[model samples]
Target: MALSFDGYKLTEIINPNGHCTQIGFTNENEPDVKKRGVILFDRQIRYIEVEEHQKFKRVKVYTTKDAEPMDFDFLEDNYANFDLFLRSIYNQ
Candidate 1:
């Protein structure tokens, strides 16, 4: 699905397991770049970008609420929990 708000256009992609990933882009006609992030839930999102860390390539997950590093496995669990949460809400 697609939504527009606050000068940004957002699109959500739901996998077969019901995990959601969102991509956002500016409302401008010619945007120089588009941004992507993982939306765990309401108000719980992480914006990430590719970076080089310790001579190795990685995607850094940035958050204002915590200083802990979010690795791939942790993010995987978040996605699984989100999928389960959606199922619980819909099954009810």
Candidate 2:
């Protein structure tokens, strides 16, 4: 999905192992509180991106229209590969 806000475009990247259906709203100003009819629904929305750098792997989540960033740590002591990490979201 794509949304135009403040002259820029926002898009959802879902299950993206580089190619897959992403789930999220691109609109940043649609007043999710009003549209969703609940305050907690706002937490369900996020802009996700995975980046690889020279030092570390990063999975970033952007919350709010201002694009405030929240970071999460994955403690994978037994996982063997990165693909397994993504697949774990399915609970299999």
Candidate 3:
């Protein structure tokens, strides 16, 4: 499923390996700007860390309008593939 957030679409990535899914958002007007993360079943959000070379820095992931601005940590041991996905995209 997909939802609109901060002028971008937060879409769920289907993973064959697990039940958890990763959500990603990219700037359509500026492809270089993007973020990939996950939303817990209870609605908590966490984004993967962008390297220093990436165009955008760490930022909040608002799942909905009027949602509270929240600080998130980089994806670590969990969802290793998803973490790689974020790195690959930012590298591009």
The global Cα lDDT (0 to 1) of model 3 is 0.42
Expressed as tens digits, the lDDT of each residue in 1-92 for candidate 3 is 33335455434444433334345655577676666554433233334333332333333443333355533323333345445544443432
Task: Find the candidate with the highest TM-score and give its number.
Answer: 2
Candidate 3 is scored at a TM of 0.28
Best by lDDT: 3
Could you tally the backbone clashes for each prediction?
A: 0, 1, 0
For model 3, which pairs clash?
none
TM-score of predicted structure 1: 0.25
The Cα error of candidate 1 at residue 44, in Å, is 1.6
Q: How many backbone overlaps does candidate 2 show? A: 1
Q: Cα lDDT of all candidates, in order?
A: 0.39, 0.36, 0.42
Cα deviation of 28, candidate 3, in Å: 1.2
Sliding window of 10 residues with minimal summed lDDT for model 1: 69-78
**Candidate 1 residues 16-39, lDDT tens each?**
333343433344654664654345
Those runs of model 2 whose alpha carbons end farther than 4 Å from true positions after fitting are 1-43, 64-66, 73-85, 88-92
- Structure candidate 1, residue pairs in collision: none
**Better model by TM-score: candidate 1 vs candidate 3:** 3
